[model samples]
Target chain A: MSPMPTESAIAEKRQQILQGAMEIFLHQGYEGTSMDRVATAAGVSKITIYKHFADKEGLFTALIEQIAEQRFNRVLGGIYLEKEPEEVLRHIATQILQLIASDEQYVAFFRLIMGESGRFPELAQLFVRALPQRAWKVLGNYFATHPKLDIANPEATARIFTGTVISYAITQYILHGEQIAPMPSDVLIENLVHLIVNQSSS
Target chain B: MSPMPTESAIAEKRQQILQGAMEIFLHQGYEGTSMDRVATAAGVSKITIYKHFADKEGLFTALIEQIAEQRFNRVLGGIYLEKEPEEVLRHIATQILQLIASDEQYVAFFRLIMGESGRFPELAQLFVRALPQRAWKVLGNYFATHPKLDIANPEATARIFTGTVISYAITQYILHGEQIAPMPSDVLIENLVHLIVNQSSS
Candidate 1:
């Protein structure tokens, strides 16, 4: 929109391009997406799109990082890691479970990334590093440092915590397990926190 | 291979075709696989393939069921349901985790099914019914019937047990989380069982 690309303006354009890319990628999947199509969707020329991203893979990687960071920030951003384990763990479990359950595009994007992972392993790697891995550090650190919890393997415990929630999502959404393995989301969340609370106390 | 289609021979042919289908489908994916490719791979005519399976979807569905059933039967079949909770549960966890980890095609098939879920929701439905749902019932019923465990909610607990294991696999294999959130397979398995055993006893 502006002739002179200020830093903020360039950042804004990049956001616009990523947004358009998400729409196309989700609708068409990774294999089906094209840079030309992205340019048209973003209201920019192909050259302009390339000016921002190195190539198709680079653009997709950026999109993956952006989405993962956004979700990570929203869910993991507010937690006081210093709080008691039950409450803090519960906050994270609730945030991730509900956040993933509600976001269909996010789920679809996940399927897309996973579906394409065989051909595009690096993309999957980008996602792992961006979201799940980052969440691990924050949660892992909390478990390690907290006096009350006193976990032996903070990393493993953290994985167990998020793993239950993520697998619940995988079964419920990814595998379409609601009709089959139908447990209320709250039941899972309650029991998850309960297990940790019980473990630490004993 | 046989001149006349004996009952045994027809079944044998079906197995051969499915083997070929799995190879083609995994490599080419559901969207890219064509009947002609399947016919060539199977060493059968398209008509012969059609006689065995009604359509491409039918063939893929059958393949999904076959893979899930084989794994299920292998893991759940030999386990003596009458065994104690810790031993039985540990057996199930080890079998499922090791079975999945060793089988790249199974993971790849899972990725294919999930990746194509948006476009072909029916395929996903088939998988849930075939694998996760079936596993849920077996484990859920065990939790319900077992007098020792005295689980508050058998279904929820079952989900937690399997969910943690599955999410473990998803991170390590599907999302390539080994580099990011690394942990040994035995560590995850041992801890998961320990958590359950502790909960039930308490």
Candidate 2:
């Protein structure tokens, strides 16, 4: 049985479902989870889940989109083009690593998204549409403003930089687990900053 | 409906099943696939597969071990530790990117292993036991001798450096589907070398 819902109440219920869904999705992955489990986890009726999201696919897509938007907005929002180039990039790199290390939900989310991306490719497309292209555009624009960088290829450089930070997190947390060697965040940021900043200046 | 295996032939049959299993596993993932599919793909009897591997778990474990050994050995083997540190690291990076980009079976194997790693944590452990630790030990030793370099944290730095490259390939090929980035491989290597070595020197 399902209760009739008002729009705002429905929205609140939807948010609750997404939060629970994120937890289960991150833990069990997409194929491993079910709508019934999500409904139970959310404390909402299964019919309520259906009413909010047409099916499991819809629910999953909505959940990914919602989080993607939040993540995109959060990370990208903090990245200011107006700042000095080196500082802005260092801030972005530090921001990325800090968020990956601290946010349990985010890491789980990334793991879930990556784990299932091969099976349900639209989830990947949703991520790509949300994040990378936008980051590239911002980065390219930033490099465009900095004629002194001597970077012949801003986009490629950005990929290299992006790859470096991401690979670090994956190795430390996901692949290597607790046995990984400890380096302070500042050391990483310092080394990375040195790599990106022009050395001729100093 | 199984033929008697000759003493010497069991090894050949096992090799055949393992080869076919990689393709099927890569395409369908762990749960979505079946032993029947693998047997059929291998052109071997179901009984033959069982005689060798007993069950899906056993078969998968063997397959993972085989692939991991091949992958880690093939990529890491080419880089001579005896070479200068900069040359060795650059060559290693290029080899890794090429492996991630071109080797579909390896990529598929990695994705499948990582995807199911949570449920079958032994697989993740297998990866750590096989690759990153050995790599760290080798790289750490290399960095220790390179006194002129300003590497404050050798092992952490290596992991970060490796992660960055892997993440780039995953984003470009597996996730985003950029078959080839605009830059040539050597040019890409040059740029990476610039960031890693030249930047540090200055």
Candidate 3:
């Protein structure tokens, strides 16, 4: 443009591009999506897109990072040591189930990751680093700090808790549980919370 | 005239075709795999494959059925009413983890099912019926009959048990847990069994 864009304008444009890219990526998947498609979808000049992201992989990485941040906020943001462990655990489990089970975009994004991970393992690695690993660390640290819980092993407990919720999500949402028989989300969350709290307290 | 194929010959050819189909399906996926490719991999004529199977879908179905049967045998083969609930649950858990975690072929097949499921939902339905649904029925029935365990909801309890193990396997194997940190199998099993048995008895 003839005039320089303002910082706010640049930030707004970047967000627009990322949102467009995520829509395309979720629908077409990583292999099927292209930078040109993203540019068109965003209604931005190729130059502007390139200004924000280096390439498709770069754009995809940015998109994943953005999603992870948003998800972390929605799911883990409320978790606090000040809250009782049951309340915190229930919040985490419920948020996770809501995100992974009910959200079509999140489920599709996960499917895209699982489908494309073999070819683009780096993307999978990026997701792993961004989400599950980070979540485990946060939860593990929380468990370790609360010795009153008497968890035999914080790391293993974290894995079990996260793993149970994730597994329930994958089966119910991704793996066609709707056609088979749907397990209500509350039931799953209740069972998981009970198991973890009971075992840890004992 | 060609000599008529014997019973054993027909069985051998079918097994060869199934084995070859499994390898190609795991490698190339459902869409990438072709009947001709299966014929070549099996070292049998396309005509022979067609004779044994109605079409590509049929071949894949047969292959899935075969895998399910074998897995059911290996994993749930030892369960008996006479065994201790603890022993039976532990056996089931160990077999499941061993099958899903370490078996590359099983993991690859699962990936194939998940990847293609969005496009070919029938395959996912077939898989759900063949494995998880079947396992749930058997385990649910077991839990329902064993009043000593006092499981409030056998169906939900079964889902929780199987879901926990399957989720752990997927995280550790499919979701790139190796890049993150790995949890030992025994620790997960120990925690899960303890939780289930304690809750049921209490």
lDDT for B72 in candidate 3 is 60
Cα error, candidate 2, residue B15 (Å) = 3.5
Query: How good is the docking of model 3, by CAPRI class?
Result: acceptable
Q: What is candidate 3's lDDT per residue for B22-116, written digit by digit as tens?
A: 98887666666788989899998999898999988889878876776677666666666578888888888888887776787887777767766
| Predicted structure with the largest TM-score when compared to the true one | 1
Question: What are the per-residue Cα lDDT tens digits for candidate 1 across B1-202?
Answer: 7576579998999999998899888866777678899889989898988899989888988987788677667656776777778888878888888877898887888788878888777768777777777777888898888888767777877888888888888778877767766788878777777677677334
lDDT of 2 at A127: 82
Off by over 4 Å in 1: A1-14, A34-36, A45-55, A200-202, B1-14, B32-39, B44-58, B200-202
> Model 2: which docking level applies?
acceptable
Top-down lDDT ranking: 1, 3, 2
* Candidate that beats the other on TM-score, 1 or 3, i.e. the better one: 1
Native contacts retained by model 2, as a fraction?
0.38
Every model's Cα RMSD, please? 3.6, 4.5, 4.2
Error of 2 at A70 (Å): 1.8
| Highest lDDT model number | 1
Which pairs clash in model 3? none
lDDT, candidate 2, at B156:
55
Q: TM-score ranking from best to worst?
A: 1, 2, 3
